[model samples]
Target: MKSLIQIFLVSALLTTCINVNAMTASPQSWWVGMQTNSLQIMLHKQNVAKHQWQLMPYSGVNLHNIIKTDNPNYAFLNLEISPSAKPGTLVFNSAAGGRFEYSLNARKANSSKRRGFDSSDTLYLINPDRFANGDSTNDSVKGMLEAANPIERGGRHGGDIQGVIDALPYLQKLGVTQLWLTPPLENNMPSYSYHGYAITDFYKIDSRMGSNALYRELAAKAKQHGIGLVMDLVLNHFGSEHVWMKDKPTADWINFNGDFANGKHATSHARQTIQDPHASDFDKRQFSDGWFVATMPDLNQRQPLLANYLIQNAIWWIEYADLSGIRVDTYSYSDKAFLANWTKAIMTEYPQFNIVGEEWTSNPAIASYWQAGKVNNDGYTSSLPSVMDFSLQESLIQALNEDESWNTGWVKVYQSIANDFLYPNPDNLLVFADNHDMSRVYTQLKQDLAKTKMAMTLLLTTRGIAQMYYGTEVLLDNTGSNDHGDIRIDFPGGFKGQKSNAFTGQGLTIDQRDMLQTISTLLNFRKQSAALSQGKLTHFSPKDGVYSYARTSEKQTVLVFLNKHAEMKSWPLHYMEEVLGSQIHATELFTQQTVNLNKAVTLPAMSAVVLVIE
Candidate 1:
């Protein structure tokens, strides 16, 4: 009897241990990790049915453990499944409880071959809703922001990841090295949110644009075609309807939620406070925590969990998609300390990675302070490598619009480059004519094709990195209003039922085709020119409305001349006599004609030429 009692006691103890282990396990938890050319997944305590435990076998499921640990409660399972994984729910049986289910989605591993920023690449920025709509099936998603009319400038015409993928060849042929699309993260809001500025879920891609799998495919395919992908990241705020807003993670997760905290007025002076240790906390909060727009709720990165989550999400995308770079929106609006840490961490993993912040300040000092090498008075450091040269943009617009004058006018462009001394490396700055926010460049230049070509020439041949707004090559216009919807117009023929398609080379006006061909030729020429890629830039502004520069190295030389004034201008060869050093032969890049270097050259009004000295 005593022996029987001992056996029963031992059996009871063993049963209790098993039950404890089963109860502690997370039955609903599922995770993915990267493996060699695949992903490995581990499902914890998968409960398929009541009182029965079964493992559903899956073939072609590659699995790897990112965090291999004995601690069952906190282990991360990574796996790579076949790219053709069926769209279905994952159901499994739990040993101690009921069944569990999770959605299985295809995710691609990051590419290992490509890394870092390239100098020769030109980025084309596009607002997806305004770009193209390849699929109409998901145009009006349930419980999503209502679709607006495509003709009604502000309406959301469904432009998904697939649309971009389909248009890749068109962009590539135009000499675009990188494609920067607006944030495609989930922004399930109530109204007027087509811009994708207000993000709700950091981890999930907007379903309306297609699933996260499609996004990864876009990135991979883009790289294969020699086009890099630049993701637009938002760290300042999220839509008020975000899930976290309903459930406060901590008491101080947000600022002034109970009362209206109207944001500070736009000021270039505020950047001075970012590096000042003596700056007031109120000013700092206003700069970092203030709302960008009323509908978007500001995020407080001081909260540890929120900061960590954001940092991890960024890294996950970079590693998962093998992104070439990230274009951070409203970059200065985030906490300075957090921005520094965020950039530092990302740079540590990907040293050659390129990150361009949107400072949007017209002052060189303010913009330069945020760049990687500016030595702030207070010793505050930022790891950001590049900033959008808003200062140059401001000068360029003014120069293009005003009449020629001795002190100002077209000379403002020359004056703008003089401010290049303010930047540690002006070559690293990102120069652009216009983006999605402002008026289109062609519209700003009053729809003059000659002037448009002149601006394009200046942008491409300038010292800094160049980024072209999408549709600029085709002279797409939004002249009547500055509304975002007006600026982001649909690309003709990107949709299925459209009368014309830019990709098929149909429905384009003669002018549009000419512009496209011109841009393509220039891009292809730049691709093979070593001088344009890494040579030092030297400019000669002998007179107003005439600017000439040479990008030269030991073996190659590229000379660019811009004549903005009407009629022909005679430039004496003696002005560039120094540049003619020991070189008697020069070929016009655009016309392919050899020109005499000993005499004056007649340049047509508003004409630009790129000459390769051989």
Candidate 2:
């Protein structure tokens, strides 16, 4: 472990920009292709904005525009590449006594054809810092401000990309086709940098996590394992410790730029107001520009240079890592105009790529407004393929906790699913019972094993792309606290010497083992079930404490039954006659038991049953 750290440190020292001030170009390399015909090269030097810059020669690339920001230290050179421009180095000579050189990296063949995740894929969300620590040496790098402290609930826990790479086999066995990792870029804040949301360097992966190359390695390995990688991105803000924070790129590079001196701002957290037509200009301004906290600064994407920089950063990641998709954080917080361009640009570059935005609203109307085909009343349009299904998530949890009654129990869930029309593509929405930002499903269900199983069944088999947080298979829970540190705890057996090993199924309770097995069984079945993935879904409203739905395709039909009662009984099966189409019998996937569909179906108390109609 010590030797690995030594090698990592040596490697870091040998390559890449640890110091942005020393480099002529912000990004040392960029892509050259038809999709990305023009490149915006940002040069940051002492008073670099004061002078004129030009291309060193009339090569295949032509200098289009040199944009100067209010901040004298930063300048943007917009250059267009001719179709004949071969991938090579292009130098920009400036009167400021420095020449910025940038390498035009060759785009992989069929780069624009990379496909992103869809309903067929299930995402396993992992917080890399807490998932596992594959290497011990990088736990506490010499110069990094925050050292690894697993004891401190909110501190860095030493998990990195390698830990994830090593756990690919376990994920494959669990049957998730995609891995949605939290942001891994450099979050060089003085403390609480483990979340990785407060990115200090966009181009550089955090050293604690390993190099940027290692991140790509994780992506490549995941691909080989039939697992797609969904990178979490934050375009709304950056850590105050970011290099650009010290050097003013423009007067409006950051919202409330003066307030950033101290770090915190008077944010309203009124997320819905961004979509409200009745919202006052002052309130909208406050919500959009307000600093997130003392350590994170809200970016002013209205500035063209800053907007271009962020959009280009997204492109760089897609090409560099060959990512399956991106999960945008705080999606609506960015300037609306800038966001439209950001999403449009990415889709233009890779037409098949998918991007899901987090709007975090429980209103279907509010969330639907962010989907690609939404025709907004205010004339706002979104290029986003999907959105986090917060409305369905809230209803699912609420429906389970309440007793069966009119608009009380299963009806709440039925209504939520019925609201699917609000979205352009409901199946594309990222659906989950819980995520890193919320309580775990186990705890959210009040630790009731039966209810938890029911929740998992709906998430896995029902409409939409499912996303299960890591440790969900084993019933990970935060029983008493709402703190994020408590929510994202260590996986029982991910690290070495843990007495409880989820991987090996040692030190696990009978209940934990049961839950784990049940989750595994359903996931593996869903992996091969075309009906579950590509079928048309039709559900009946809840009656007699049993709610039912069916996902049917040309080849198969899966009938899902949910019974909320405490005791088993043969409920009326007449409602499914039409969907089953005279099929009198079916086989339960989980138990392999055969039952007559013509008669009443008997199921366990508070249980979810997936029956394949013959």
TM-score, predicted candidate 2 vs. hidden true structure: 0.95
Which tens-of-lDDT digit does each residue in 522-557 have in candidate 2? 888888889888989999989878888999988889
Q: Candidate 1 — what's its lDDT?
A: 0.70
Over 4 Å off in model 1, which ranges? 1-114, 258-269, 275-280, 496-500
At residue 364, give the lDDT of candidate 1.
82
Q: Candidate 1 clash total?
A: 20
> Candidate 2: how large is its RMSD?
3.2
Which candidate wins on TM-score?
2
Compare the candidates by lDDT and give the number of the best one: 2
User: lDDT tens digits, residues 37-95, model 1?
Assistant: 33222222322112333335555443343442232222233445554455444443446
Give the 10-residue window scoring lowest on summed lDDT in candidate 1.
Answer: 11-20
Question: How many Å off is the CA of 164 in candidate 2?
Answer: 0.3
